[model samples]
Target: MKIFENCHLFHYPFEKVSAAHWQKYPNEYATHVVAVDTLDRKVLPDSQTLYTERLITCRQGVPRWILKLVDGAQECYIREVSYMDLKSRTLTLLSSNMTFCDRLRVHETVTYSPHHELNATVFRQEARIEALACMKRLANIVEQWSVDRISQKASIGKLGFENVLKQINLSVFHQLPVPSPDANS
Candidate 1:
């Protein structure tokens, strides 16, 4: 298994960062994400936390060598679960690949927390990739490809989120409608 981790400091408060998340989709940088469907959503009994489950469909490039070995489609599906706690002022997202799970799997976790000193938010991300193919070389190639794809997506997702954060009008956050998750481009 291959693992990756990254940390980013967003120069915005946790409240803003969390609020911006509702509208991060359909951004220019996230072209690979095709569709996102909300599978379930609920608030805990106390109403201090919100839980959500979503299915994300994304299409990305697969290396020719890997494609020759495994006949799979480029489009992939992912299951994402998110939790936001108002009392703790924390947000966590966990995602896993649903497609091609027999041969390869990627599990990622991202958390956002408030910074102690500043009104900023700290973002931490970790990803674990496993290639379960019998061939060693194929496994290596698949893991590497998955790692690279994750890295690229991480950067793109960050940029897209930053843009969303900048555009959020805190006073009228409830009025703005979130764009459709469907990516026509």
Candidate 2:
């Protein structure tokens, strides 16, 4: 198992940051993300927390050393579940790969919250990789490869969010409406 953690600061309020997060796909910074299909979305009646489940397809890079051992495409499907709490100004996301679970699995979680001291929003990400294989030696190699791939994905994901925020700022500056679905709508 491999674990990784990271933190990012966005120069925006919690509301804007949350909005950007929801609209992060279809952005230039996220070329690796091929498709995103929302399987379920709803708001809890009592607390009004938004819940969503999405299946995301992404293309990843396979190390040369590992590619020789196994022959397959680098594309993978991931299941993401998210919860947004408007009252608390917090968003939590959990994601896990749906393909090739017997060989490799990556589970990631992210949390977004308001930064009172900095007057910004903070993003925290944690990921765990499990490489299971019948061969002991192959498992070690796969584990290291998984670690590198997850790191690369995390960096790209952060940059994608930042780009979304920039676009929001630009729209506000030019008096262009930043298009986003209303929470109630």
Candidate 3:
């Protein structure tokens, strides 16, 4: 699994602009803007704007999707936005798939003071790794169960215990095996 990190500069219009103007540069004026973050705060090449009227409503509402892909072949999908607080400068994001039940959660805070410099690079790195791990585990489980079920059904000529096991393995569940007293003894 590979984690792709994207930093966006979200711009909300303080005042309304003409529909024609917006249409001309819809990507520029839309609230859900995406731009790659540089060490010097410059936008990256090939990054484009996404204008989703359904997801964004000017400056007053949260967009349905906060991140968009600018590059890469990763199929990573965002599961949920756990929390976002500007006053506290904290954000949490989680991602998971149903196959392997792999899940990743990330918590990060940003602070800026007149006397110090703030950096978000480390936090971004950590969050990307966590997300990738979750995706990888889930994908692996899904792939394995698919292969097993196909083979088992072909060989056994029936969908029974093996099929059930395959279904359980693909679900988001955890089970603990317990030992009987006699067996333990």
| Candidate topping lDDT | 1
Q: Write the per-residue lDDT of candidate 2 for residues 1-185, one digit (tens) a residue.
A: 77888898888988889988778998886887899999999998899699999999988666676555545667879999999988888999999988877667789999999998987999999888877765466776677767776677778877888888998878879996556877557
lDDT of 1 at 43: 96
CA error at residue 153 for candidate 1, angstroms: 1.7
> How would you encode candidate 3's per-residue C-alpha lDDT over 1-185 as one tens digit per residue?
22333232112121111111122212422222222111122222444322121111122121222111112222222222223323333333332322212443322222111111422111221122233343564544434433443243223422232343334444424564657789957
Worst 10 residues of 1 by lDDT: 63-72
Steric clash pairs (candidate 1): none
* Alpha-carbon shift of residue 138 in model 3 (angstroms): 14
My TM-score estimates for the predictions, one after another, are 0.86, 0.86, 0.21
TM-score ranking, best first: 2, 1, 3
lDDT of each: 0.87, 0.84, 0.28
Name the runs in model 2 displaced over 4 angstroms.
64-71, 133-135, 176-185
Residues 110-171 of candidate 1 have per-residue lDDT tens digits of 99999999989999999999998565667886787778878888898899999888778554
Weakest 10 consecutive residues of candidate 2 by summed lDDT: 64-73
Against the true structure, candidate 2 reaches a TM-score of 0.86
User: Each model's RMSD to truth, in Å?
Assistant: 8.7, 6.5, 25.4
Single out the weakest 10-residue window by summed lDDT for candidate 3: 12-21
